[model samples]
Target: MQDTVRRILTARVYDVAEETPLDGLQRLSARLDRPVLLKREDLQPVFSFKIRGAYNRIAQLTEAELARGVICASAGNHAQGVALAAARRGTTATIVMPTTTPGIKVAAVKARGGNVVLHGDEFDQAAAHARRLEAETGAVFIHPFDDPDVIAGQGTVGLEILRQHPDPIEAVFVPIGGGGLAAGMAAIIRFLRPEAKIIGVEPVDAPTMKTALDKGEVVTLNEVGLFADGVAVRRAGDLTFALCRDLLDGIVLVDTDAICAAVKDVFDDVRAVAEPAGALALAGLKSWAADHPGSGTLIAVNSGANLNFDRLRHVAERAEIGEGAEALLAVTLKEDRDDYSRFLTLLDGRSVTEFNYRWSDVGTARFFVGVALKNGPAEKDALIARLIAAGYAVEDMSDNEAAKLHVRHMVGGRAQGLAHERVLRFAFPERPGAFLRFLASLKPAWTLTLFHYRNHGDDVGRVLAGISVRPEEQPALTEALGALGYPYVDETDNPAIRLFLDGARAGS
Candidate 1:
């Protein structure tokens, strides 16, 4: 089967219209003192290079098979590719997608003339349902990356890479979900250009191919993160596993933040939005480029661009830390609070990128802090030095996996919207002294309420304060609370806020 795929891929059936542009990234290249080029596959028709494999696999079907029609499962770009190709070939295609699939993706599939069905909660579930439907209807099942035809079709991407770059390509970075794209491309590149390294990129949270490579066989993840929805497969395909196991050079796992940073960089440089999976290749290149320099030339394949515009907020939230523009932190000991404050003050120019405090009992009082750095390592090192000078223990939450994923999300040691009886809302000039002043202004005698603030390291900050107030004092406090410089609105008047705030009221 592998031999057949190798031969078919060698006899390319279709061609890419225009070779993607590759150029040095001034910011990145300057930082590493090496050449960096981005392969703009996000610019392709259907906004993904998936068209290459979809067209290749479907175009090879016999007339009889075509008459029987084709069935497949995909979240977005792949579904569009199959639908468009089948329409072009004058045949029918049915695409199955998860019920949770984004509306934009469903619309894209329909736009390509696919008979779309939403089923299950994840890709594997959709694929299973597609298989059952195919068996019942006798439609030819088109595997996304597992089948020989699919893998061979994907290999055409590798051929295009060598054809596009005149130099002795040093390394090629390909994104992996189920390993179909990575496996096929790696095998072909190894066969044609053995010295040109083939590296597979997978999301750190969903390391399907990485797990296979580690175990020497395919394995399913107990849980898979859907942050990079396009490439969040729990298990890799068997054929792809075999190919990648024997042919690939290395596996690079990128976190959500890195992918977001890559997406932001691509948009900044070329005004293109790379969906998470699409940016994986660039993220992989940026991850390993420093140590693997001068292998010849570096080529990264931008795989897909089926992105949800609404999800951009989540991506932006992480991109700051990915680019080292922000630092994440976890502090230990309430005794160190004073020392920590002094250390932070010494970071004069630097700002607190993010800070969420919550009660913790780790044998010591602690709070997690996230700092933003306009400058580089110097500022971080100085802050660390000051903390140590003050006889405080410092944890560089930047490199702590627990802090980044679990701790940061679990800020304040509790969930954000969880409520209580009273919310003392306040507005203050977004300045360094503002928070301290608020703390000073509040009477500790009163029990706490929900406190929420967004500090963009700016001049004016918005704060929501929830406190436990006696039922009798509520009306008088509401009328008199405006005396403070900041205006206060009684959110309890709003039904939703009241319900949430009332729930947050702590138990005696």
Candidate 2:
């Protein structure tokens, strides 16, 4: 540990990296009643802290190793780091990336003079391919987080934080992917500033580090959510897991909606947009503050800004619910105009952010509505209770994933005579012909009942589809879907789908 700290102190990354600022998040601090600081690693030349480790690792390689060249596999940020680092050193680099990687990232790597090889559909597959290429070409493989040099390189961020603040910090939140950043920073913070706590943050859906710490060994996940693609690692690195297990004070797990809310919080305070993974540390900090009320100085690493522009719409839509600033409801009303007037009166002057209504039948109509909440979750629950007391049937849709991701956009009439219907939600690469390929993979005997798709400007495209199949045919249908090789969820029993599309009891 002492040698690692020494290496961090003498890390030779300044030629391609900068001392990013530790900016105060004044608005968030005031709201949370604490001193909140953000280490702006997003402001680096590559818009991420990955450059620090990448450059430091490449710079120390022997001349013969550089001559043999370098190779790596990454979905995005790390590929850019290696490409830029190798380019600066006047050496060749080959980057193996998932075919599902965003086009923006692929172009960036190519522009940085790295040879791009698109393979597989996920990081694990691409990494396997990169390893084969390394053996074949005799090139040095740059593991994103496992190596001593890379970890030491990233440790510099912790050193900078201690030097810049010069004040007693209660906790420092670092996002965990393969645990590079968290492991590096935790080692330094544990040794140099034992008084301060080092907390690692991870998406609830991809809690690789947390799981590793619990099991006391590295464990690969069967699947991980890709929304926060930058930190969607399936397993913690061996070296990184060892360091974080010994050094980190704790680990915090946050969900997607909370991550979206934190992104908005950062934007509100700094006028800078953060990708989901970039805002994960802030999300964890907020979760921690909410649970452990009293706070001192807290630091969150603003990790990266490599976001797809189209994804901003989805983030903006969910930020309100994630922050508990908005309540989504389904209220049943009579089709009469007077009932509509009465429904408006129940709102009690609160601003309505969104309103979507469709008359399912003549007797009662169900409307999907979004209302601004003045005092967050408490107010939302109170409003729901009051509405029910007033003899209106209501269902809260604020936390429903199906409602937020699909139902809100495709609320419509029930399909007539759609018997033995099964609904499935899918996520697949958004490249051209991908949808067509999926359709081709389906069995010809099944009838397509309903389909809804929207491009969120992300690498993955979300799809909601209904298929008409007899109970006996369900096994065959499942087999066909598995053959398609896309991540999916069976939404046949989703409450929102039942109310909006399947004509189940309204507001039930």
TM-score of each: 0.78, 0.81
Check candidate 2 and list the clashing pairs.
none
Which parts of model 1 have CA positions greater than 4 angstroms off? Answer: 1-19, 290-296, 330-344, 356-368, 374-382, 391-452, 455-508
Global Cα lDDT for candidate 1:
0.73
- Top candidate when judged by lDDT against the true structure: 2
- Report the lDDT tens digits of candidate 2 across residue range 1-508: 7877888988988899999999999999999999999999999888889988898899999999999999999888889999999999988999999887877778988989999999987788889999999999999999889888899899999999999998899999999999988988998898989999999999999999999899889999988888898888888899999899889989999999999999999999999988898999999999998988876999999999888888888788888889998898878866555565566677787766655554333567677777888799999999999989888899999998898887887665575545777878888677654555666666666655555554444678777777778899999889988888899999988987787787533355
Off by over 4 Å in 2: 414-508
Candidate 1, 21-40: lDDT as tens digits: 56456666556566567777
Candidate 2 matches the true fold with a TM-score of 0.81
